[model samples]
Target chain A: MANMAEAVNVEALGAKQRRRFPHINWLALAMIMPSVIALLLIGLYPLLFAVSLSFQRFLLNRPQNNGMFVGFENYAAVLNDPLFWSSLGRTMTMLVIVLIVQIVAGIGIALLIDSSRWRVLNWTVKTALVIPIAMTPAVVGLLGVLIFNRDFGLMNYLLGLVGIEKINWLGDPTMAMVAIIITDIWQWTPFAALIMLSSLAIVPHEMVEAARLDTKSPWMIFRHVKLPYLMPGITAFMIIRTADVLKLFDMPFTLTRGGPGVSTELISLYVQRMGFRIFDMGVASAQAVLLLILCIVLARAYIHFFYRTPEAE
Target chain B: MAQAQNLQTNLLAQQARAIARRRSRIPASAWLQLVLLLLLLLFILTPFYWMVSTSLKEQNDTFAIPPKILFTPTLEHYNFVLFSPSAIVPTGLQNSLIVATFTTLLALLLGTPAAYILARFEFRGKRDLWFWFISNRFISPIVVALPFFLIARDLRMLNTPQALILIYLTFNIPLVVWLCLDQFRAIPRDLDEQAKVDGCNLFQSFWRINLPLAIPGVVVSAILCFIFSWNELLFALILNRSTGQTAPVQAANFMTGFGVKWGEMMATGTLIVLPVVLFAAIVSRHLARGLTMGAIK
Candidate 1:
C-alpha cells in the first residue's frame, strides 16, 4: 500500500510539473481537514489525555480526592503491585506461546497446501482454513466454553473415544490458561496459514528446483530454499500477532474472565478491570501507557527488522 | 541428433520424476495428504459444526454424551433467541446494523476526500498527515476506552449508537483513508487532468471522475467497517452498558447472567458468525488484504 501510494505521488508530481493548472493546494488541505480534526479529537487527544491521567490520582473509589498531581506515583504503585507484574508476565507468556504455535502451525498448513497435488483439494483446504479467521473472537471464546464443557463437550467425548480421561479444560487454572491458548491458536492459526500460503505462492519455483537438484533430503531443501522465502511472511505474522496478543481482551474476557484466580489475566483485561470495574483510572492509565510503549517498541523493532533485512529481497 | 536429444530429454524427465519422488517420499502421498487435510479440516470446522449443531439440537441432545453427531435438528434455540419476550438479539442486531452502517458511511465520507488529496496532489507534510490519520489503527482500543467514555459522558452521548459510531471513527477513518488512498492512486491522473480541461473543478472532477472508479475500495472499506463494528466487544461493552449493546456484547451477556444458556448462546454465536463469515467469503481476498493494511500482495 505504501509503495503504491508513493509511486502514485511521484507520478502525480511529474504530471503537475508538466501541466501547472492553477494548483489549489488549499483545496487538498480542505479535503483532508475533517478527517484530521476528527482524528485529533477522537484519537490523538484521548491518548494524550490518558497519558495525563496516568500521572494524576484520579481514583474513582477514592472520589474525595480530585485529580491531584500524583507525579509518577501511579507508575510507582503499579510497578510495585505484584498483580500488575504477574499479569504482564502472563501476557508475555501467552504472547510467546500463541505466536510460536500459530506461526509453526500456520507454516505447516501452508506447506501442506502448497504441496497438494490436486487443485480442488488445495482450494477446499484454503477455504476451510479461512473460516475460523472470520469468526468473532468473542464467539470463539464462547465456543471454547462449550467445547471444554466437561460432561457433554465434544472435547471430552472425543477424548473418551480415544480412551483418555476427561480434563477440566477451563476450571483448572493451568488448564484454563491452556484453554485460552488453544482457543487463540484455533482462531489465529488460519490467519498465519493464509499469510504464509500467499507468501508461499510467490516463492520462486526455480529456487525450489535448484535446491532439489542440490539436495536429496527434503529438510535440507526446505532449510536452504523455502524457509528463506517464507521469512518475511513469518516476520510480518510475528509482529502483527505479537502486537495483538498483548492486547488480548475479548477471548479471555469471554472464555475465562482471567479465570481461577488471575491466572489468565492478560494485560488488557487487567487494565480494563482496573480502569472500569475497580475505577482506578490512575493505575489503569499507567498500565495502559506501559502496554502502549511495549507494543510500539515491539512493532518498531519488527518493522525495522522487516525493512532492514536484505534477506527479504 | 534427434535421437540423442530425445534420449537426453527422456533421461532428464526420469531424473526429474525421481527427484519429485524423493521429495514426496511415498507413492501414496496424495492419499496421505488427503487424509491429513481432512483431519485438519475436521479440526478447523468442527467447532463451527458444533456451534451450529448445538444451536439446532434439542436442549437435552446438546449435553448427550458420545455427543449426537446426528439428531433431529430444531430451531428451538433460534426461536428463543429471536422470539423470546426478553430477547435482546433483535435489539442487538438493530444496534449493530445501525452503528455499523452509520460508522461505515461516516468513515467513508470523512476519509474519501482526504484519500483523494493524498492520491492526486502534492502537499506539505503529506507523509506526516497520512501517518497521523492511519496510525490510530495501532492504538489499542483499551487505551482509549475510558477517555472516550468520559468524553461521551461529558458530551451526553453515552449509551447511544452515535457514541459508538464516533469513537469507532478513530480506527474506521484511518482504515478508510488507507484503503481508499490506494484505490484512488490506482486511477490515472490523466483522467483528472482531462476532466479539468473539460471545465470541471477539482471537486467536480474528483466526484465525477475519481469517486466512481473508487467504488470497489469504498465498498470494501464499508464492509470492513461494518464487520469491525459488528464484532467489536470492548467499546460496545464499556460504552453502551445498557440499551445499545451490540450483538457481540449481547452474545457475551448470555455466558454470564443466570446459568449458562448453551443453546441460545450458540444460536447467538451462529448468528454473529454467519453474517461476517458470509461477508468474508464474498470478499475474502479483500478482507485478507485489508487486515494486512495492503502491505502484502
Candidate 2:
C-alpha cells in the first residue's frame, strides 16, 4: 500500500512537471497586474476604509475632527438607531415579496412559453419581456412615476374607467412600497422567466414524457421532474435578485425620494442619506458594514443550500 | 404478436390523423396560449408604450386625463430634449457613450488576461482570487459611494469622466473576468496545448488562438459592460455631480426640480432605454447564459 501511494505521488509530481516556460509566472503576473491593482484600489481599499471609517469620527460637515478613532461608538449608534432597524426591515420585506412574486410569475411565464404551440408568438413575447429587463433602473423608476402618478397617471385613469376612485400610489407610505414592488416586479420577472425558460429548454423531454405517462396530472410531472431541473436556475435567480433588492436605491431615489417619511427607504438609500445627506459618515459606515454582513450571510446560506453541505457517512 | 402489431398500427394511424387535424386548424390549447401571450405582452409593453406615447404627446396632451391614445403625435418633447443648447440630454448622451465605451475597452484589456489565467492555470489561491473578483459584483455600489467620493476628492479627480471610468472598473473588471472565464472555459484546452507544441509561447497561444475564439464572449461581455455602465446611477450620481452627469442621472434629476416634466423625462427614458434594449436583443442568448453563470448552455 505504501509503495502504491509512493507511485501515485510520483505520477502526480511527474504530471506537475510541465515543459519549462521560463518567466511564465512573471508574464502571468504582468498580465493580471492591471485588474489586481484596480480591484485593490477600488474594491479592497474602499471596503477596508469603510470598515475603518465605521470605527472613527468622519462626518463630512464636521471635518475638523474627522478620522479620529472612536471604536465601537459608530456601531453602537447604528445599533441604537431605530431608523436603521426599520429600514433594514423594510429592505428585507421588499426583497422577500419581490422575489416571491418575480419567481412565481417567472416560472408561470416560463412554463407557459415552454408549452406554448405558437412559435412566432413565443419569440415575440420573449422579446417584449426583454424590454423591461433592458431598461435602465432609473428610467424604470421614472416610468413608474408616470404610470403611478396620482391624478393624471395611467393607473388612476384606468381605475377611473372602472368607476373606482383614484388611488395615491406614492403618497401613502404602504402604497409607496407597493408602487416600488410593482416597478421591480415588472423589471425583474422577465429576468427570472428568461433564466427559467433557458433551463427548461434543456430538460430532457423523455423524463417528462415518462412522468406524464405515469401520471396524467401536470402538477405531478412538474413536482417530480421540472422542479428539480429548475432548482438551480431558481437558486441563481434568487441570489441575483436578493443581492439586487438589498442594494436597491435608484428606484426609490427617483420615485419617492424615500418620501412621505422614509417609508420606502431601502438600506442603500438609508446608508446614502446617512453619509451624504446628514454627513454622519461613521454611523453610515457602521450601517454599511452591517448591510455587508447581512448580504454575505444571506449569500452564504443560499450557496450552502444550493451546493449542499458536506456530510459524514 | 399479431394483435400487438394491429394495436401499433392503429396507434400510428391515430397519431398521423392527430397531426393532420393540427395542420387543418389551430388547436384550442394553442389559442389559449396565444391569448395568454398577448395578455403578458400587454402587461409588459404598456409601461413602454406609455413612455414612448407620452414622449410624442404635446405637454397638455401628456397630462390629459383618460390619456390621449388617438391624439396627433408630435416631436416637440424630443426637439426640446435634443436641440436646445441648454439641454442636458445631448451632453448626457455623449458622456454616457464616452464613459461606457472606454470602460468596456479598459475592462476588456485588464480582464482578458486575468480570465485566461483563471481559466487555463491551476495556480495557488486561484479559487480565493476568483471569488474575490466575483464578490465585488455583490458589493453594493452605495456602500462604496462615500469612500469613493472621499478618495476622489482627495485625489482631485472629482466630477470628471475619468473618475467615473476608474470607479466603474472595480465592478466592470470583475464582471468581465467572470463572464470571460466562462467563455474561455467553453473553449477546448487541447487547442492551447497544440499551439504550445507548435513553438508558440503561452502568451502567443492566448493572443493568437484563444482571444480570437473568445470574440463572441468578449462581444457579449462588452455589451453587458456597456449596458451596466450606461445604466449605472449611484456611482455616477455621486462621482459625476455637475459637468459630467450621465443620461440616467439627468433623467432622475428631472423628477426633483419643480413640476414633474413627464414628457421630457419620458423622452430621456426612451432614449436611454432604446440603445440598451437593442444591445440586449442582439445578445439575448448570451445574456441569459451569462446570467445563469453559464449553467444553462
Candidate 3:
C-alpha cells in the first residue's frame, strides 16, 4: 500500500510538472547560468589547475625550470617526504582528539542546559556560545598566545592561584601542541554545544515522557529517546568538522606558525610552507590533491554510513 | 471504623504537606546544571573579554602580574591603531568593508535566483549541481590559494581588493545557495501557482511572491557571508598583502615585527572581532542551520 501510494504521488508530480512547465525549463536554466559559470571559473578551474600543476615541476621562485612535466614525481616526493608524513600524522591526531573532546563535552553541556527549566539561562548561554564561533581564528590564535604565555599569561596566573607552577605552553614542543588543542577546544566546543542543543530541543516530548515512565533513569531515557534524534545532527557535525579540521589553517597559523620547531605543523601549514614560503608549488599541489581526495572519501563514507533521507526515516 | 477514617485523613494531610514542600523548593540538580551552564558561558566569553580588556589597558597594565581585574582604561592603543599616520588598520578596515559588502551583494544576486530554481523546480542534474555547490565548502582553501595567487600575480590583480572579492565567491556563493534553498523550500508551492494564475511569469512570481517571504533567511545568509569574508585570513593574507590587507590580516601583521606590540595588536583584534560578534549574536538562532548548511535543522 505504501509503495503504491508513493508511485501515485510520483506520477501526479510528474504530470503536474509536464502541465505547468516545459520539459526543459529554460527559465530555470537561464537563472542558474551565471552562478554555474562563476563557480566553474573560480571553483572548479582552480582545482583542475592545481591538479595539472601537481604533475609538473613548478617552482615559483625558479621560474626557469617550472612547468616541466614530471609525471608522478611530485606525488612520489610528497609521499617520501618525512615532513609530509609527520604533518599528516599531527593533523590526524588533532582531528581525533578534538572531535572526541568537542562531541562529548558539547553534548554533555547541551544536555545540562536543555534539562534546565530557566528560559533566561538557556537564552543567555546560547547567545554567549555565538561569540567563540564569531571570532576570527587568527585573532583567536593571538588570544591563545596571550593566554598561554609562560610568564604573564592568564592560564598560568589562574594555575598559580591554585598553587600549580607555571608551564611553558608554546615554548616546549609537546606543550605547544597541547596549547593548540586547548585553544581549538575553547573556540569550537561551543559550536558543538549549540548545534546539539538545537537538536535536543526538537526531541519528541511524548516519546521522552513514555521512556521516563518505562524507567526513572535519565541515562536510559536519553539512550532510547534523545540519542536517535541527536544522531543526524551529530553525523552532520562530524562531516562538517572533519573537513574543517583537515583544512584548519588560521588559528595555528597565527598561534604557533607550526612551531617552536615544526612540532605543531599540520598538513595545511606544511602545504603553505612548501607552496609559499619554500616556493615549491608542485609538492604543495600534490599534497592539496591528496587532502582533497581524503575529504571526499571521508564525506562519502559518512553519508553512506550515517546519513538518512527523510524517506528512510 | 472510626480509627480507620482518622488514619486515612492523616495520610491525606501528609501528602498535601509533601506537595507544598516540593513546590516551594527548587531541585538541587537543576541548580547544579545552571551553575555549570554559567561556567560554560564564562569559558566562552573569557577570550573575548581578555581581548577587549587588553585592548583598553595601558601597555604596562596589560602585562601586570595577576592580570589586573581593575585598572585605568586607556584609548591610546585604539587611537594608535585607528589614527596613527603609519597605521594600516584603517585601510584594512575599508578594504574589508568593500570586499565583504560586494561579496555579500553579488553572492545574493547570483545565488538567490539559482536557489529558487533549485528549490521549486524539478530538473535533470539538479542533485549533481547541488552537491557540486556544497562540496566547494569542503575543499581546503590551500588547494586554491596558491593557484589563485599565481593567477592573480599573472593578471596583475595581486594586492587588489578585487582578487579577494572574486576568490571569496567560491565559498560564499555556495553558502548563499544552500541556506536560501532551505528557505525557499519552506515557502508553500501554492503561492507560486497563485502568482502564475494572476498572470505572473516564472521570474516575476519568484521576485514578487517568494522573495519577500524569504527575506529573513536571505538576510541571515548575507550576514554569514559578510562575516566569513570579513573574518577570512588566508586568502586576504595571500592575495592582498600590502594595498588590500583586511582587518584580520592587519591584526596578524602585528606579530611579524620585533617586540610584538601587544596593546596595539589587541586593539586591532578587538576591531576585527566587534562587528562579527554582534552579527553572530543577531543570527545565533539560525547559526546551526547556517553552519551545517541546513542539514541538521
Candidate 4:
C-alpha cells in the first residue's frame, strides 16, 4: 500500500495529490472518499447501529431491524446472565495471566536478545519473532489445536516423556479456558517483545553504563533506569494488547469454538454466537456496547498516559 | 507491595554482584549472551517450524508417540486442499483472493487521499479526526459482526462474496487511512505545493507527486489489509454460510469435521501459510521503508 502511493507521488511534484478547491483538498478528498465511505457505512454504521440497537429489541430473523425501545433490557440481560459474568471473569483472568506472561517473558527475552551478542543470534531471534506476528490469528488457533490434542498431540507426547498424563487441552472445562489463554500468549508474546524491543532501543544507554559504573546490579540498573524508561512502552502495549485480547474471536473460534461447554467462551465469542447462531442482534449489540465502553476506557487511559507529555499538563 | 519490594531487592542484589564483578574488565559475556539470544529465537521459532513440519508429515508421522523429530514428507495434504474429491468442502482460495484484492484496492483508493489530506492540510478538528480514526481500530471485530450480519441477512445476501468484502472494508479502510496518514506525513508537502503553484490542482498534485512518493507505505498497508481480510474468519463465518467461505474458514470447517484428516489439514495449512510467507518475504523491504514514516521527514 505504501509503495503504490510513493510510486504515484514520484511521478510529479505532488500536485496530483491536491484538489482544485481553495480550502478543501477536494481532489485528495475525492480519491479518499470511496474508502472512507466504505469504512463509514460498513465500519462506522455497524458500530453506531450496535449502540442504537442495544436499546431496542432487535432480532435478525424478524423483518424489522428495530424492535421495541427496551431501555437497558439487553444490558440487564447481560448483567443478569451468570454466563456473561463468568466469561467476564474468564476474560479478566486470561488478561492477567497472559499479560503477566507476555510482559515478563517479553521483557526478559527482549533484554536477553538486546544484550551484547553476536549479530547472527540477535538477527535470528528478531527474524523468528516477526513470523508469528505475520501469521493470522485463526491459523495460530488451528496450529494450537493440532499440537495439543489429547489422544495424539505433540504437547501430550512431550508431557508423556516427563511422565505426565495426556492432557485434554480443548476438552475438560477446567483446562479449556487455560488452553485458549496459552494459545493467545503463544501468538502475541512476540508482539509484546517486538514493541518492547523497539522502545528498548531508545532507552538511554549512558544511564545504563553509569549505573554499571556505580556498582548498581544489572537488576538495579534495569529497575531504576530501564523500567522507568520502558514503563510507557509497556503501558502502551498493554492498552493495545488489552483491547485486542478483549476483542479476540478468531483464535477461540477456531481452536475450541468457546467450548468444553462455554468454559472458554470469551465475551466476544458469546456475542458472536448470540448474534450469528441465535440471531439475537439486540443481545449481541448490548454485548458490543459493553465491549466498546471497555475499549474506550482503556484507550482513553492509554492516551492520557502515553500520548500526553508531562509538559502539556 | 512487600513481595514486590522483596523481589526488587533480590533482583538488584544479584545484579549488583554481577555488575561489580564484570565492571573491572567490562569483557563481553559473548557465549552467554549468544546462547540466551539463541534460546529466545528458539522460543519464537520452534512453533512455526513445528507447524511447517506437521504440514509435511504423513498421518502416521504427525501423530508419532515420541513425536517424530524427522520424517519423510508427502504432498497428500496439499493435493487434498487444492483438489478435494469430495465437493462438500467449498473451494475458498479464489474467493479469498478476490475479496482480499478488492478490499486492498478499495482501501487504497479511499485511504491514500485521506492520508494526504491529513498530512498536507490543517483542517478544523483534524486531530479529532485522527483520534476518531485511530479509535475505530480499537473496536473489536466481533462488535461489528452482529449488526453487519443482521443487515446483510436482511438484504438476503448471506453467504455471498459481496458480504465478506463489505465486512472487510470496515476495518481495512480505517487501517489504510491511519497507516497512510503516517506515511503521507513523512513525505514532504513541498512537492505538492510546488505542483500546485505550477498549475496542478489538488488531485493532480496527489496523483502526480504525492501518491508516487507514498507507494511504499501504500503497498505495505495494502498487503496487510489483503492478508488480514484473506485470513479473516468471523465475518466470513457469519456472512458466508455457504458459497463464499474463505480458505481460513474452510480450513477451520475442516478442522471441526469428523475424522480429522491430518494429511488434508496439513495440506490446507501449507496452502494457507505459503502465500503469507511469500507476501512477507517479497515485500520485506517495503515494510522496512514504511517503518521510518515519521522519522525520515
Best by DockQ: 3
Instruction: Identify the runs in model 3 with alpha carbons over 4 angstroms from their true place.
Output: A1-22, A302-313, B1-24
How would you encode candidate 3's per-residue C-alpha lDDT over B1-297 as one tens digit per residue? 999999999999999999999867878887888788788878888888998999999889888997999998899999998999988888888999999999899999999999999888766667678777877878899989988888999999999988988999999999999888888988999998789779999999989989999999899999999999998998988888878788888777777878877888899999988999999999999888788777767
| Residue B22's lDDT in candidate 3 | 82
**Per-candidate DockQ versus the true complex?**
0.43, 0.45, 0.56, 0.34
Candidate 4 chain A worst ten-residue window by lDDT = A304-313
Which portions of model 2 show Cα errors greater than 4 Å?
Answer: A1-24, A301-313, B1-20, B23-25, B295-297
Give each candidate's interface RMSD in Å: 2.5, 3.0, 1.9, 3.7
Tens digits of lDDT, candidate 3, A1-313: 9999998899799988897775777887899899999999999999999999999899988999899999999999999999999999999899899999999998998998888887898889889988988899999999989889998899999999999999999999999999999999998888899889989989989999888888999899988899998888788888888899888999999999999999999999999899999999999999999998987776565445543341221
Which window of 10 residues has the lowest lDDT sum in candidate 3 chain A? A304-313
What are the runs in model 4 whose C-alpha is more than 4 Å off?
A1-35, A61-66, A306-313, B1-28, B87-90, B281-297
lDDT of each: 0.83, 0.85, 0.88, 0.75
Question: What residue pairs are clashing in model 1?
Answer: none
Descending-lDDT candidate ranking: 3, 2, 1, 4
Angstrom error of the Cα, residue A248, model 3: value is: 0.5
* Residue runs of model 1 more than 4 Å from their true location after superposition: A1-24, A302-313, B1-26
Question: What fnat does each of the candidate structures reach?
Answer: 0.58, 0.62, 0.74, 0.63
Q: What lDDT, from 0 to 1, does candidate 3 have?
A: 0.88
TM-score of each: 0.90, 0.91, 0.92, 0.86
Candidate number with greatest lDDT: 3
